[model samples]
Target: MSDQPRSYLVLASQRSGSTLLVESLRTTGQAGEPQEFFQYLPSTSLAPQPREWFAGVDDENILRLLAPWKPGTPSMETPQEWRARILDAGRTPNGVWGGKLMWNQTPLLTAWADGLAGRQADDPDAGDLKTAIEDVLGPDVLLVHVARKDTVAQAVSMWRAVQTQVWRGRADPEVDARAEYNADGIAHLHAILEDQERQWARWFGEAGVEPLEIDYHELASDTTGQVARVLVALGLDPELAPPPALQRQGNDRSNDWIERYRAERISV
Candidate 1:
């Protein structure tokens, strides 16, 4: 095998079943850990709260809360260090690395990619986001664009996630919160999802990156087949036995929320 690492990215939007895809890839063991390495960007946008709320909290504490990975760990201080750490952590024993990035996180992704390529954060020569990513991760990096075909379902899922702030299940107990149906809120989320999809398309076109497009519905239906497809795309052995089933994350309230929104719209 070539000395260069085989890297790939799952390009997706919120509530697009990306977590499922990433977990499937990760379980393969041949595929590296694919996670939201740039999640800190979104955390940085957290709304300002009262000073008393964070009183006596150190910067490290704040970073630990905001960062996806354990903060204050070695090589976790600067963005560059974090990128290196993530890439190293994600690398498989076979030298394969995988990551998942959302379309809306362009700024953070660009900066991380630039750092990987040893360029200044705002380097103009870094080119577009795709180019920058390719520069660091290698030109042959596989791109998997996962999208949700059901816009209404995707929007409602995102809305509920935002409302409850419970994106995934953990060992810790979580307060189950049912999402209230708001036609206008769902509509706005739907529009944002549509716009982000368009942006991904435009970015792929401009960057001349031909991505393996996968749908959320199909992924949910036949996860094994979808994962095999991704493996094959990355020039890996598709004949290998599939990984164990991935545990479902989100609750099953999206469909009900969508129905309620439709009913409300019709009544309006």
Candidate 2:
């Protein structure tokens, strides 16, 4: 209802440096808490498990490396309740709201939005994606597209994470030590990451929406600058952007896996 934008959404995929950007944004007290609010699966009420990523892959070798699937309780919140929680949880005292949305979780968002729409009105347009986002976050939400240029590196990072179940900060040395490099597993994630990026681009093109774009390398190297850019877009003070503190999760092992996967793919 205010003239200033009160909500912002980060459009990104797994292991794309989105966490770094969001965490930085969150440090600024003015910026609303930017979390991966849409990653949960309605059926499991949990973010996708490690084995779930390799669902169609019948490779026992790859399957054996990933953590075994564990069932989770389903979310019981109705559309209105879910909407209220997300809106409240993501907001700061300043009334600004922020959250992250991956391409894979769009279905869950749309379904929840549809349920809300059905309850609110009989209008057919209320169930659309744009309408859904507006219905929950208001009409002036700033959209930010955080992306990684290198799919191989992204996939390699994701492969390691899926194995360890540690997405942020440092992983346990003993637990991370157990993660093995599987070319097929990395390749599988590479394809998924590529497709998710492609879908974001295509959707933006089709919808005629031009979001503020952030590159992974640029974000990593100049995190404060990147966060300032988003704050500027949101009509907030750029000086509120916090200095970068989080370190990159990638390391020598990730680099080795990237090179190995490239070499194996080239030979095939």
Candidate 3:
């Protein structure tokens, strides 16, 4: 392995099988632990909530709420310290670092990246998400864009997850609950996914980045092949054995929820 670390970003939207991909990549022990490293950042919001809920909340309270999501991160560390630690810890013995980020988390990432480069927090030049990423990762950082081809399914998944507060397995029991279907909410989520996809396409065009795109369906069907493809894209040895199987999270409940939402929309 080269002395200089190889870095990559897994750009994805919510409920897009990104977790599966990240877990698989991590199993290789070569791809690095590419998780939502910026998740604990103050401005990071995984779901929509009324602003009033956080009116009197300080950073400590926010960190407490974020504890369940961010593993291996101490609650006492400041955001800047957490950012630095995450980058260092994400690297594997093979000198490869990987990270996954959703489009909605871009603001927090941009701010962290700006600080890394010693750029002004509000600098327009520092505002470019791609540039900010490369500033810290390196100039030739590879990007893998993972998306769910079925917008309806993806939207339903996001809607259900937001309602249930169960984005993955082993979630807090206190937040575990069955999700209710909402036609308007599902439709809104679908629109948001479409807009986010378009935004990603636009950014790729502007940045001249031809990212390796992975479909959620294909990834589920052939995890090894997809992982190999990602390895090859990152100039790693593709012959490496696939990682151990990950515990599947979603189930028939998601499909049931989708059907319920579809029927509700039709009736309206």
Per-residue CA lDDT of model 2 for 195-222, tens digit only, reads 9999999989887889999999999989
Could you tell me how far off, in angstroms, the CA of residue 69 lies in candidate 2 after the best superposition?
Answer: 1.4
| Local error of candidate 2 at residue 127 (angstroms) | 6.1
Between candidates 1 and 3, name the one with more favorable TM-score.
3
Residues 1-268, candidate 3, lDDT per residue (tens digit)? 4533388889988888888888888888888878787665454433334222233434442323322432233355544676678778888887788998887678867877776667885677777887878766778777899988788889877765665566766445455453455566667678778877888888889988888899988888888899999888777888763853575556676678777776776455
> In model 3, what lDDT does residue 111 have?
74
lDDT of each: 0.70, 0.88, 0.72
Considering every candidate listed, which one attains the maximal lDDT? 2
Clashing pairs in 1: none
- Number of the top candidate by TM-score? 2
TM-score of each: 0.76, 0.95, 0.78
Q: Give candidate 2 misplaced runs (Cα > 4 Å).
A: 119-127, 266-268
Give the poorly placed runs of model 1, Cα more than 4 Å off.
1-5, 42-76, 115-127, 169-174, 241-244, 247-252, 265-268
| True-structure Cα RMSD, model 3 | 6.0
